[model samples]
Target: MSVRLRQATLGDLPLICRLRVQRTAWLAARGSDQWTVAGKGRPIEIFAGEVGRALDAGETWVAEVDGEPAGTITVNRRSDPGLWSPWELAESVVVHFMIVDLRFAGREVGRHLLDHADRLAERADRAWVRLDAWTTNSDLHDYYRRAGFQLARIAGPGAHGPSRALFQRRVVPAHPARTAPSRYSLQGYSGGNSAM
Candidate 1:
């Protein structure tokens, strides 16, 4: 199946929130508390607010598979305050709110989204793509490892959130000969708007 990505608009808020809730349920079923709050999923209002900010900043993208919304991701230069040293934030494109609909699982939608992040980093002249995963989600950590990320470090006690498992992968330019034409395309992406 082919995946396409487009900049997310405010109108897409409900779709993104639904994907988040779906993912939360999926994780909970697996006995993981990644996106939950006291055994229940995160409240839609709080999550929607976060996604709304990203949408307004033009940092969020929706991934569509077979012309249907399958996932969403937000990448930008701003790291959550105190999660990364200033130097690290300056040199990296931070990823957030990456969620894939369970129906699209195993279809490499997540990998394609990361590739999109890599391309965005390359275009912005950043050195790496960095993200903070759920601190207790070992499966998520392994998934990131298989996707080329290396564990940087867990945040110290001073960090405020539960998503403190830091991971980063260097931005390696894709060799032309081996690089396949992307099945996905970025819509409304402007270097000036997205650059750090």
Candidate 2:
């Protein structure tokens, strides 16, 4: 309810840094396979570097709900190299570090972020959107399947030791309006908007 996605820029670095800590802590609590670093840790510098690169590439996004930052996603052209495979590498839009604040987990925040990435990927002329998840989290894997991603492969057991599974969804091209619609008309809500 009342959620929107904004393009991420250099100004968001601080917020992204904070959210990385929150997300990493939550993942550690779950003892989920998502944590691949030795000692169950991820350096903020690493997150910062990744976010900085994505922003520089014009691929990061932030989701705000009720005027507050509620989620984050890194949508980039970078390929994830460690994922196992039924997933074939294609020229695809890659989505990484998808996180919705745990306070809003049961809500559709994560879905909205992902759907936005899907639309963005399509607009970039990508054939598919790809992502990876920890191999041990059946619940999360199932959640993605329901959201339309097909399991591609289970790669990983990376240096950090947690295996990861790859997933992908083909993007359907959207039909653009030949002429602009009325300024005040509320067009159809795309998947990037709240489900509610």
| Each model's backbone clash number | 0, 7
The collision pairs in model 1 are none
All candidates' TM-scores?
Answer: 0.87, 0.77
Model 2 scores a C-alpha lDDT of 0.66
TM value for model 2: 0.77
Taking the tens digit of each residue's C-alpha lDDT, what string does model 1 give over 1-196? 8799888899999998888878887777888877778633346698899889888888889889999998889998776556789899778788888988888898998998888898777766678999988888888899899999999999988876677889999988765343454433333333421000
Off by over 4 Å in 2: 39-42, 82-90, 156-163, 173-196
Q: Tell me the tens digit of each residue's lDDT in model 2 across 1-196.
A: 8898887888988887777677667766877535436544346687678778777766678899998888888775555455523334345666777777767777898878888876776555557878776666777788889889998877645523243567788876555532333221111222210010
Against the reference, the lDDT scores of all candidates come to: 0.79, 0.66
For model 2, which pairs clash? 83-155, 84-154, 84-155, 85-153, 86-152, 86-153, 87-152
The Cα error of candidate 1 at residue 51, in Å, is: 0.6
